[model samples]
Target: MNLPVMRVLLAEDDPHDAELTLERLAIAGLDVEGVIVNNEADFIKALDSGTFDLVLSDFHMPGFPGSEALRIARSHPSALPFIFVSGVLGEEHAVDMLKEGATDYVLKQRLDRLPIVVQRALDEARERRSRHDAERRLRESETYFGQLIDALRDYSVATLSLDGTIESWNRASEWLFGYPAEEVIGRPGDMFNLPPEPGQPTERPLVERLAEISTGTSLAEERWLMRKNGATFYASVVTTAIFGNGGAVRGFSRIVRDMTDTRVAADLLQMAKEQAEAANRAKDRFLAVLSHELRTPLGPIYAAAQALDLRQDLPPECRRSIELIKRNVEVEARLIDDLLDISKIVNDKLSLRLEPTDLVAILNGIAEIFREEAAARHIELRYTPLPYPVIVQADPARLQQIIWNLLKNAIKFTPRAGEIGITMYQPMPGKIAVDVSDTGIGIPPQALKRIFDAFDQGEEESAQARGGLGLGLAIASSLAQRHGGTLSVRSEGQGKGTTFTLTLDDPAGGDVQAPAPVETPASPSTHRPATILLVEDNGDTAEAMQFLLAEYGYEVDIAENVAAACACIDAKRYDVLVSDMGLPDGDGIDVLRHYAPAADQIAVALTGYGMESDVRRCLGAGFAIHLTKPLDIDHLIDVLQRDNRS
Candidate 1:
């Protein structure tokens, strides 16, 4: 459908001869378009135009001879064929002219041969042009590939012979292995390889048929290579074989990358990790000691206050003061508990008891906790009760804790008469969002990003006035994440107000039916007053614990050391052994070992060391239950009664 256009320059003085030549070229099956010139100037001009493929000239023109035209054609950059078609030329002259540069001579009387001669000359010229074009393209391709190969300074790219010898190397090879191409080439590629480690089988690595089945994959392992100076560096290398048309091996290409820095960095990172782990262990040990020192004294203080509160003959003012003392003591105990909990969370030790619970009921209970506090501050606390139960799969206690934290912060930062709002709504299917918003001093732009970080106070000026460790939001956020949810905050600006939202994926829709309830183990209904051996080092704590146990129908024997406890155990049979972890003679666990094998008795640990690991250690020592100090008497009674009945 498409054809090439060819330009022919016909150098003939006579117009008739030029017309005849054009007609003959067409007849010879030449697809040519021609330009005719009559003189030396026109012929020279046509040659200078540089658009013609074939030049046919009259050998004996008035000024321009066929020889002169041939000379001019040779002078130009392109090779143009010049031919003689003259009538006045003798046989000798024609032969002489042919020897001088004319392509072929055709006598005028034999003008019938002009087309034949013209066709043959054009064919040879086309073949020559094609060969020149292919050579030019080859040169350009070699130049481009050379530039690309030299540009790679990171990879030691090389070409190899089929026998695993290096044939060529790039600049990276010189820099990486410290070997110049002159020395490395024609040498076996394994010159730098060390032997495989013990227990690894020897195999030829370079000739492995990797690329035949896979385009790319990581090699089995990193190999060590020796440098020119005898020092070793690790290298990650890959070799791909070059294949040809019949799937025959045509040498190979190997690419090597320096991994010495990566190897060194990995070692450093491992050391850092070990150091961090050691630091965490030390921190845990310190917390254990601190918890024991702090909580041991609180046990006696709380018990003494309770003993005072129970005095019927005491004055009402005195009773109120004792109650205040008890409440403040409980507050201090709660702060210590918070510190322990945060440590547990940081160490990924926070455990959860997940159950399908009524979210609405939990929210209502949280609202009731802060109602008095909100009123004391002259602030409005508002929440709408849910008409129906919204059940969710969550740890009920943790969920309550998150809400308590946000509500406490809302109450703390809000000024007197400021409004605080708590709202819960399902914005869409498979979604539940709870928002706690307040008209308080909002967070500034600079502090917003770090508001959820532990101990980061958004309002530095109010940190002391607010009087908190600023760990609530951090704990809340962590708890939310552990629940497969998120907690985020937004503020308009300082003094404008802030809103915190908690979002959870509600795959269990509101309309979904609840599962049938499971039965719980009922306590055995039997009458029994248990005997308790209270082993405590502190005199006041032991006295108060014994007094509290007696009120619950427990006959108590006090032991302030391991020897005293062992004596009491040998003398009398006891139903429960309540002991502190630390003792003057030995650990409380040693007392358990002495008494536990003698009888079937319930052992309980009432200790000041209250980390999760400490509890595990106590449980591992055969205690039925591990309880921390500043004891909740009701919970203790419940535990004691359950074990006594069992």
Candidate 2:
């Protein structure tokens, strides 16, 4: 319970009057502290010397009047409260004192009213100081904001009135347009625009921009603008509408930045991009021709190996050597396929034939294929599928390829007697997760960040020993994303083992009932012999395939080119026609058109071009089957036998 203290400056010729004033202020529960001065010199010195809440002066002092004291106190910078307390102050002189700057007057006979007058004057002084401080702060803030706008040397900032006349211009604006503030303050905002050519409207007039900003708030655009010297340069301009406190549109603010050099650089980059695309197209064409040329020689080699393998009297070592040759030829063909697949992916040419397929069944089958390879390295490869079918809309062949790549890497990196497991489970509702984990030397912390990047093999010595082009994970990751799934990897550190997870959407979302498994039927034990006409441009490939078909109990005729095949076709009708896509005279499509086989007769195409477009072309040309070279002999024989029975 502390009371407020009021300090007083008292001007009195007699000490008794000042004492009486202090006693009256104290009676009102105000803790009064007073400084007394008797003369004019002492009163003025007291006012300047220290802080006081209010001033009390006697009306008639020796050579000093309360009116003079009131005048001096009012003119002081502090705005201190002033009151007259005197017995000689008549009503007329008291009224004059308050009008001259006295806060209020109290007759000495009415000393009881002095406390009320002093208290009200103290409260009023406090309010005046608060208002003065607020106004000073506002003025300082506005000055600082103006200085900040002038400091931005690279941009021109201007303000426009509601009618689109310039109202304010910053220093940068003066430097940019070569006009002083006085000259541009009342000018139209469009004074900096480049003149329009005859019959051509001006580019995005100020009024049109303002109309858009009235609805949308802001607009940014690029156009050429004229400088003071009539030279034109590109500029990026941003204009925003200014709103008043009551939400009415008041004015607009515009910012301009020169962009002539940036515009030139952008045009150069666009030209470079076009040139790079053209170079990529040429590279694709070159690779197509190269693949055809490379696969042509492998056809003869592979077919001759199959022909040798068919001989039963051959030595065991000679048979094993032929098997090795066949296996390596297939491996080489796969390497070529990888190169072409990467090209297709980069150009967004890869496509999927999607269907609702059994995901668990596909994983189990892939695991079986890799079991023998894993056993050869003394690795325990394990994959256990769910009891029920996990169905998803996906391309089965592409899905198999993705899993094969992940498992292949796991086996390659795992040492002898290491463990590798494939697990599938629901990570959450509506999502399916497949994890391929291996007890191999794990990825280093630094390498894990970029493990799926193209051509980024880890810096591990073991990884270097297992050679590859480092495209498998990159291609698999990209394919996973294309199928609306994701591929991710986690490893603790080097030597702690690694796990690669592939996540996909579960189409049915929850547990589903199992469907009865469908069993595949066995192929026919023997083939029905047929007369076949073969067209091929490569002489070695033609001889090897003809000899192999003869061994398979088929009557085979060889034609070196499309014209020879046509000549043979015109002479006799054949049960089957085998032709190559690329020939010296023309392609196999021309031969098929010339042969014009009946609906009962079958046409088969063989070629080195295995692109999706090439396969579609051969099938659309009435070929019953299209086989890519270097050809798989067993598959071709099975195709002929199956179709022959039908």
Candidate 3:
């Protein structure tokens, strides 16, 4: 041991023994600072104010003893070492003092060893203090690391040893995996009971994978993990090797995030995008088909009317036949408009005007309208009365459209002498159900799955013979869904009758008085001749309309441009004006606004854009009727006939 300076306090009543001890310590090569206290008061004062590295006390004193000095030093914050020096003390007494926390005990006669004993005790005390500081630092570091892990909420943090044993689990891990730290701490990672593939023996054989990780490898992958209740969810896992002081691999730390909901949301969004694209394609196809269907009939009606107008000596019967052609063309145009409306409904672009609608009255009106169609088909159409007055919250026009389409479909499909039955009844207290059944070729079992889909048609021979565009039921179903109701079909395959049921929830209220009906105007026979101006850019279409209208008793004036139509409007007061929506100079709306026709003078809009917004804008612009071309001759005749008398 190296020689060092030592501060020593000596408490003894014998002056001889204390002198001998100091001399022996000096001879041992220690630089000694020594204080001798022979009484209790002096020893207490010295211990209170003085500092010493070691305390050497005699076993007995006049007023203080070695045992008393040891007690005093033990109670101090800075615990000074006490070495007992005694000549007469028994072995049992020395053993008791040592056990009571004395640093060491030496016989007074053996003063030569005092310096060596003092040096050893001081070195040991310094070592104990260093060890205490190191332990405190280690505990603080552990606490800080634990808090860091607990603060994370998004992902569960955990660690596994080289054997795939769970060594640590954080608070987030406990919450996410539904396991307490105590339960999972020493368990294997695969004890969570994950899903096993067909022939796989274990859910996640992480032990084999961890061996590679412990050898300084890294892994990043996605796997499904099981919860406490055995429900599996996807997780993104990242693991890497932890290193020791010498850069050797230690263990691994893993971070996992649950991706089950995220994956599901992504899939759903992709599906919706695909559906929107498909709907757009269908809309494009419908518009193309509608354009072809409307333009086909305009050719014949225009030619017949033009021929009749140029003939000044035409017979009365020949003149009437030309008028008939004009009337039928208008009817066909109306049918096309109806079909376009159904397309809007199918695409969920149709808006409704909500009002209190009387279902019975609407059904009755539909029966009257389709009575002629049914008669012509030689099919008997019947509507049975409901047990109670059924009033519903619905759009009146839309409801009429729904009932009309269903009725028309029934009449079209039913063969001659077939029976068609329509019944309205309250299936529940606050709900109304309408059933339309036809004794015709019924739907097949295989085709029933897609019957409500737009453009879907049945394979029944009769339905194929009496062909349709297959949009009626699709429109009906969409309307029903909009009304918080449903439309369903039931049949016993082909050759049997079919029933379509429409169930609608009734509005909140009891029965109320029904509204008065508006009667359709009587069909006119006497055609009044009036001045008319027609503006169209297409030569063939314009020539046809002028001839057809002139032959039907109208003084028809035709213009191929906006400037010519404006000239005619300024020169003469016409009873009615007909214009194509798209013109060479401007649109029809521009022509109508420029002329600023009187309120009494009727204006009709004819265009190929048959969207609901298109029709609404035309009507909002003060047009009396919105018609899309190819123009229906009969519908045009009705409108013209109505305007002629007005």
Rank all candidate structures by their lDDT, best first, as comma-separated numbers: 2, 1, 3
lDDT of 1 by residue, 1-646 (tens): 4446668888888888888777776776667798988787887787786688788878888777777887887777867877787788787877776677667877766778987887788888888889999999989998888778778888888887877789999888899889999999899887898778899998566545443423433334577888899889988887776776777767777888889999999989999999999998888888888888889999988888876766689999899898778877777776677777788999999887788777778889989878877997898999997777677778998999889889988988899989899998887888788899999988888888998998887767779878878888989999998888899999988998889998877756656445446657675545567788989999999888787777767889999999999999999988888898899889889989977833457888888887988888988988888988887677788997676555
Residue range 255-365, candidate 2, lDDT tens digits: 999899999999899999898889887877776677788899999999999999999899999998998899789877876776777888888988888888788889989
TM-score of each: 0.65, 0.61, 0.53
Error of 3 at 401 (Å): 2.7
Local accuracy by lDDT, each model: 0.82, 0.86, 0.78
lDDT per residue for candidate 3 within 1-646, as digits (tens), equals: 7656688899878788888888888898888989999877787788889887888888877667778888887887778888898898779989989987899988877777777788898888888778978999889988998898888887888888878788999998888888889999988866764557789775447777777777777898887788886778888888888898998777788888888898789779999989988987677567745664565457546555756646889898888787667556655654565577676775667888778778887887788867777887788888765544467889987787777777877776678999899987667777778999999877789988898877677775555787767777888788888888889899898868789999888774345545556767766646456778888777777777777776677788888888888898889888788887777788888889876878668888877767876778889998889876766566798887776655
Q: Rank the candidates by TM-score, best first.
A: 1, 2, 3
Give the higher-TM-score candidate: 1 or 3.
1
In model 1, residue pairs whose N, Cα or C atoms come closer than 3 Å (at least 3 residues apart or on different chains), thus clashing, are none
